[model samples]
Target: MLTRIVRMAFQPEKVADFLAIFRDSEDKIRNMPGCRHLELWQDADQPTVYCTHSRWDSAADLDNYRRSALFGQVWPATKALFAAPPLAFSVYPAGVESSLSSLPASQ
Candidate 1:
């Protein structure tokens, strides 16, 4: 499985707007093909910061979603509210031994 995480820092006044967009689109995104799980998270120490945790069947499934019309609509609106560029990455669970070699080399 492919797990994806995206951390975003939004403009203070735009937090509500971002939530609304997520609320409107969450179900559609979760129902997309190969979507195994989806969640939204807010930082405890940073009110303006939020993250999305999602699981997909494969990297290609995630990529397909990235290119979909739903993403086209949601991403632009979401990024417009960002106070900083978002941080996004994907990984496999640590328990998955095969994924170990795919991790980036330590600095």
Candidate 2:
């Protein structure tokens, strides 16, 4: 399994718009092939900062989704609202660890 997180900072006033985009697309994204999970999180101390957490069966699957029309449409819209380029990275688990508590195993 692969875990991915994207950290984004948006114009404070664009929070609602950003959230609405996520709300409208979360289910579709979660249902995509090889997608195991999807979630949106906002920084408690900095509400304009947000992060997206997701799990994919493989990096290929994630790449495929990124090239798909869904992403083509969604990403540009989302990117336009960002205050800066998003920070994203991937990780692989080494057995069970407390740091991974927030992630569930792929079903």
Candidate 3:
């Protein structure tokens, strides 16, 4: 599984618009091929800041979505609402067994 994270800082005045766009398009995005999960999160102290967390089967899956017409439409609308450039990255599970083994057992 490939996890993708995107941080967006929207213009304060455009937050509602951004949310509306997200509401209208989230279902389509979540239903895309190879999309395993999707979630939106808001920063605790910043009302204008939001992030999208998603899981894809692979980077190529993500790339396919990015090149789709859905992205072409959504991204331009989303970009117009941003106060700053978005930050995005992808990561894979980092050996869960090794991390679990390092944990101490307690009663």
Pick the lDDT winner.
Answer: 1
What local lDDT score does residue 21 receive in model 3, on the 0 to 100 scale? Answer: 91
lDDT of 3 by residue, 1-107 (tens): 99999999999999999999999999999999999999999999998999999999999999999999999999999999999999999998879897888799977
Candidate 1 lDDT over residue span 1-107, tens digit each = 99999999999999999999999999999999999999999999998999999999999999999999999999999999999999999997676666777799899
> Candidate 3: which stretches are off by over 4 Å?
96-107
User: How many angstroms is residue 106 displaced in model 3 relative to the true structure, after the best TM-score fit?
Assistant: 33
Off by over 4 Å in 1: 96-107
Give the TM-score (vs. native) of candidate 1.
0.89
Q: Per-prediction count of colliding residue pairs?
A: 0, 0, 0
What overall lDDT goes with each candidate model? 0.97, 0.91, 0.95
Which residue pairs overlap in candidate 2's backbone? none
> How do all models score by TM-score?
0.89, 0.86, 0.88
Best-to-worst lDDT order? 1, 3, 2
- Candidate 3 or 2, higher TM-score: 3
For residue 20, give model 3's deviation from the true position in Å. Answer: 0.7
Per residue, candidate 2 scores C-alpha lDDT tens digits across 38-66 of 99988999889999999999999999999
